[model samples]
Target: MNIAVIGTGYVGLVTGLCLAQVGHYVTCIDIDTNKIDQLQKGHSPIYEEGLDKLLRENRQQKRIEFTTDYDMGLADKQMILLAVGTPQKNDGSADLGALFSACRAIAEHLSTDVIVVTKSTVPIGTNERIQDYIKQHAVNNNAVSVVSVPEFLRQGSAVQDTFHGDRIVIGGENTEAVETVAEVYQPFNIPIIKTDLRSAEMIKYASNAFLAAKISFINEVANLCERAGANIDDVSRGVGMDKRIGNHFLKAGTGYGGSCFPKDLSAIIAYGRKVEQPLSILECVQRVNEKQMDILAGKVSKRFRGLKGITIAVLGLSFKPNTDDMRNAPSIPLIQKLIENGANINAFDPAATETAKTLLSDKVFYYETIDGALKGADCSIIITDWKEIIDYPIKLFKKHLARPIIFDGRNCFSLKIMKENGMEYYSIGRPAIFPIS
Candidate 1:
C-alpha cells in the first residue's frame, strides 16, 4: 500500500515510519522546512525512543521519503493520513486551523480516488464536516472518502505502541472505505474495530478522559490515605489485585499532564456544554487534577513555613519520563508557584532541560547532573521519577542538601530507607519519615 502522512509531529512521524516498516511505501509531508530536512537526512526532530533507528532503516530500504510539496507527496497515494495537531483553544475547543489547512492543500492537489483517514483527534461530528469541506473544495472530481481512524499512541513509547496496540479502529459511513482502511492495518496483525465516524471520534476523547480520571482518582485517594494513616502503595497494590481494576494508571502522583489529557478533557467538557449533555464527573476530574498539580508546591511551602528565600533542588522537569515533551508539565506551575513565594529552583531532567527552558522562567537554574542540581540546595523535591534520579545513591541526598529534608511527589524512595538513612522525607500518601533518634 502507498500512504501519505501529513504533519510530521510525534504522531505523524511514528505512524509513517512504523507503516513503512510494515511494507508500505510512506511519504511524510510537513510544512516545516527544517523538520523535513532533518527527516530527509534520517534524523527525527522529536526525541522518541527507537524512532531515529526506524527512520534510518526505512529510508535505507527506500520505503519512506519526506517532502514539503503536497503535489509530490500525495501523488498516486491510496491513503492520506491526517496526523496534524488539533490543539486546544482558549474556549477549550479544538483549534482546527492546521487540520483544515492540510485538508485544503490535499483537496487542491488530489487527482485520484483516495481514503482520507483522520488520525488527528477531533470533535464527534467533525469527520462529516471534513468530508463535505474536502469535496466542496476539490479542484478535481476525485472520489475522496473521509474516515475517522483516530490514533492511540502514547508519547515516549509510541513506536512500541503502534506495533503492539490492542486494536485498530476504522470508522466510515461507507463500508468500502472502512474495509480499505482495515486492509492497511492487516499487516499489523492487530484486531480491527469498525465503527461509525462519530463513534470513532468520540472513542479517542472518551479514552483520554477516562485515563485522566483514573490519575485524578488515585491522587484524591492518596490524599485521603495520607490523612488516614495508610500507605497508598499498599492500597494501590491491594485494589489493583481485583480482576476488574487491573491497575494501569493507578499510581498516585502529582496528577497527569502532557499534550493529550489536559486539552482533551477540556475539549470534551466544553463539547458536553455545547450539546447540553453535562459531563459532571469529568468536570470534577479536571478540577481535581488542577489541584493535584499544586500538591507538591503546597507541601514544600508548608514544610518550610513558606518558600521565602529558600533554594530547592528539583529532580525532573518533564511531565513524564522517556520523552522531552513539556506541554502543561506539572513542574511549570509548581516552579511558578515556588518562585511566587520567593523560593529559588535548581531543576534537572535527563531529556527535558532544553524543552523545559522554553516553558520555565529564567530565574530557575538548570543542571546537567542530578547531584549538581542538588549541591548546596536547602532542600529537595522529586517532580519526575526518571530512572537516573531514582537509582542515584540515597546517601547523596544527605550529602548534597544543606538540610536532609526531601519531598517526593512520585514516591521514588521508600520510607524505611529514608528513615534508616537519618533523613527527613515526605512522599505521597505515606507516613512522613523522621530520622530515628
Candidate 2:
C-alpha cells in the first residue's frame, strides 16, 4: 500500500511509522519544512516510546519517507490519511479549519482513485463535509472516496496501543474504500467495526468523553471520601472488583489533563449544545476537573498557612509520564496558582523539561535533576508519576526539603514509606499523613 499521511503530529507520525513498519510504503507530509526535514533525517519531533526506533528502522529499510510538498507527496499514494490537528476553539468547538485546509489541498492534488481517510478526532458529520468538499473541488471527483478512520491510540503507550488496540472503526459511504482501508490494516490482527461516517466520528469523541467522565467520577468520590474519612483507594478497589466497572481510569488524581480528555469533553458538550441537547454529565466533568487542580493548590496553602514567598518544588511537568507532552498538564495551573500566592517554583521532569520550558519559561526554575529541584525546597508536589521520580532516593528527600512537606498529586509513593520516613505526606483521596513532631 502506498500511504500518504498528512500532518506529522502525534497521530500522523505514529500512523505513518506503524504502517511503514508493516511493510507499506508510507510518506508523511507536513507543511512545516523543519519538522519534515527532521523526520527525513530519522529524527522524531515528538517524543513517543518505540516511535523513534520504528521510524528509524522503516527509514533505513526505504519504506518510509517525509516531505513538505503536498502534491509531490500525494501524487503516487493510494491512501491519503488526513491526520491534521483539529484544536479546540475558545467556544469549546473543534476548530476544523486545519482539517478543511488539508482536504482542499488533497483535492487539488489527488489525481487517481484514492481513499481519503480521516484519522483525526473530528465531530460528527465532518466526514460528510470532507466528502462534499472533495466532490466539489477534487480534480478527479469520481476517483476519490472520503472515509473516517478515527485513531484510538493513547499517549505514553501509543505504539503498543496501536498494535494491540481492541478494535478499529472504519466509516465511509464507499464499500470499496472501506475494504481498501481494511486491507491496509490487515497486518495488525484487530477487529474492524464498519459503520457510517458520522458514527465513526462520534465513536472517538464518545470514548474520550466516557473515560473523562470516569476520571471525574472517581475524583468526585475521592473528594467525598476526604470529608467522610474514607479511603478512596479501598473504595475504588471495592467498586472496581464488580467486573462491570473494571478498574481503569479509576485512580483519583488532580483530575484528567491531557490533549484528549479535557478537549474532547468540552467538544462533546459543545456538540450537544448545537443540537439543543446539552451533555449535562460532561459539563459537570469539566467543572470537576478544573476544581480538582485548584483543590490541590488549596491543600498546599492550608498546610503552610499561606504559600506566599515559599519555595515549592514540583516533581513532574508532563501531564503523565513516559512522554514529553505538557499540553494541558495539571502542573501548569497548579504551579500558576501557587505562584499567584507568592510562591517560588522549582520543577523537574526527566523528559518534559524541554517542552515544559516552552510552557513555563519564566514562571518557574527548571532543574537538571530531581534532587536539584528538591534541594532546600520548602515543600514538594508530585504531579506526573514518572517512574524515575517515583524511584528517587527517599533519603535525599528527607535531607533536602526545608520542611519535608510532600504533596503527591499522583500518589507516587506508598503511605507506609512516607509514614516510616516521618514526612508530612498528602495525596489525592487519602488522609494526610502528618509527621510525628
Candidate 3:
C-alpha cells in the first residue's frame, strides 16, 4: 500500500513509521523544511521512545520517506492521512484552520480516487464537513472519500500502543472507503470497530473526556482521603480489584495535563454547549483538574510558611515520562506560582531539559543532572513520574539538599522508604511523612 501522511507531528510521524514497518510504503508530508531535513537525515523532530530507531530503520529500508512537497507526496498514493493538529481556541472549540488547510491541499493535489482518512482528533461531524470541503474544491467531485480514523496512542508508549491497541475505530459513510483503510492496518491484528463518521469522531473526544474525568474523580477522592485520614492508595487498590471499574487511570496526581486531555475535554464541553446539550460533569472535571495544580502549589507554600527566597528543585518538566512534550504541563503553572511567590526554581528531566528551556527561559535554571538540581535546594518537587526519578538514590538526596523536604506529586516513591530515610515527605492522598522524633 502506498500511503501519504500529511502533517508530520507526533501522530503522523509514529503512524508513518509504524505503517512502513509493516511493509507499506509511506511518505510523510510536512511544511516545515527543518523537520523534513531532520527526518531525511534519520533524526526524529520529536522525542518519543523507540521512535527514532524505527524511523531510521524504515528510512534505511526505503519503506518511509519525508518531504515538504504535497503535490509529489500525494501523487499515486492510495490512502491519504490527515494527522494535523487541531488546537483549542479561546472559546474552547477546536481551531480547525490547520485541518481545513490540509483538506484543501489534498483536494487540490489529489488526481485520482483516494481514501482521505483523518487521524487527527476532531469534533463530531468533522468528517462530513471535510467531505463537503473537499468536494467543493476538488477537481473531480466523486474522486475522494473521507473517513474518520482517530488515533488513541499515548505519548510515551505510542509505538507499543500502536501495535497493541485494543481496537481501531473506522468511521465513514462509504463502506469501500472504510474497508480500504482497514486493509492498511489489517496486519496489526487489532479489532476494528466500524461506525458512522460522527460517532467515530465523537469517540475520540468522548474517550479522552472520560479518561480526564476519571483522573479528576480519583484526585477528588484522594483529596477526601487526605482530609478523612484514609489511604487513597489502599482504597484505589481495593476499588481497582473490581472487574467493573478496572484500575487504569486511577492514580491521583497534580492533574492531567498534556496535549490531549485539556484540549479534548474543552472541545467536548464547547461542542455540547453549541448543540444546547452541555455536559456539566465534564465541566467539573475540567475545573477540578485546574484546581489540582493550585492545590499542589498551595501545599508546598503552606509547608514553608512562605515561598519567599526559597530554593526549590523540580524533578521532571514534561507532563509525562519518556516524552519531551511540554504542552499544558502542570509544572508550567506550578513553577509560575513558585516564582511569583519569590521562590528560585531549579529543574531537571532526563529528556525534557531542552524543550523546557523554551518555556522557562531565564525564569528557571536547568540542571545537567537531577542531583545537581537538588544540590543546595530547600525542597524537591517531583512532577513527572519518570522511572529514573522514582528509582533515584536516596543517599544522594540526603547528601545534597540542606533540607530534605520532598513533595511527591505523582506518588512515585514508597512512603515507608521516605520515612526510613528521615526525609519529610508530602504526597497526595497519603499521610504526611515527617522526620521521626
> What C-alpha lDDT does candidate 1 achieve relative to the native structure?
0.93
Write one digit per residue (lDDT tens) for candidate 1, span 1-437.
Answer: 99999999999999999999999999999999999998888788898889989998999999999999998999999999999999999999999999999999999998899999999999889999999999999998999999998899899899999999988988899999999889889999999999999999998999999899889999999999999999999999999889898788999999899989999999999999999998999999999999988988888888899999999999988889888999988999999999998999999999999988988999999999989999999989998988999998889999988999999999999888898899999899898998877
Task: Identify the runs in model 2 with alpha carbons over 4 angstroms from their true place.
Answer: none
CA displacement after TM-score superposition, residue 42 of candidate 1 (Å): 1.7
* Model 2, residue pairs in steric clash: none
- Candidate 1: list runs displaced more than 4 Å: none
* Candidate 3 C-alpha lDDT tens digits along 145-184: 8999999999999999999998999999999989988998
lDDT scores for all predictions?
0.93, 0.89, 0.92
Sort by lDDT, top down from the best: 1, 3, 2
Instruction: Write the residue-wise lDDT of candidate 2 on 313-414 in tens digits.
Output: 999898999888888999889888888889999999989898888788487999989888999999899999999989997778989998888998988887
Q: Which ten residues in a row have the lowest lDDT in candidate 1?
A: 428-437
- Each prediction's TM-score against the native? 0.98, 0.98, 0.99
Please tell me which model should have the higher lDDT, number 2 or number 3.
3
lDDT for predicted candidate 3 compared with the true structure? 0.92
Candidate 2 overall lDDT versus native = 0.89
lDDT of 2 at 35: 96
**Which candidate number has the best lDDT?**
1
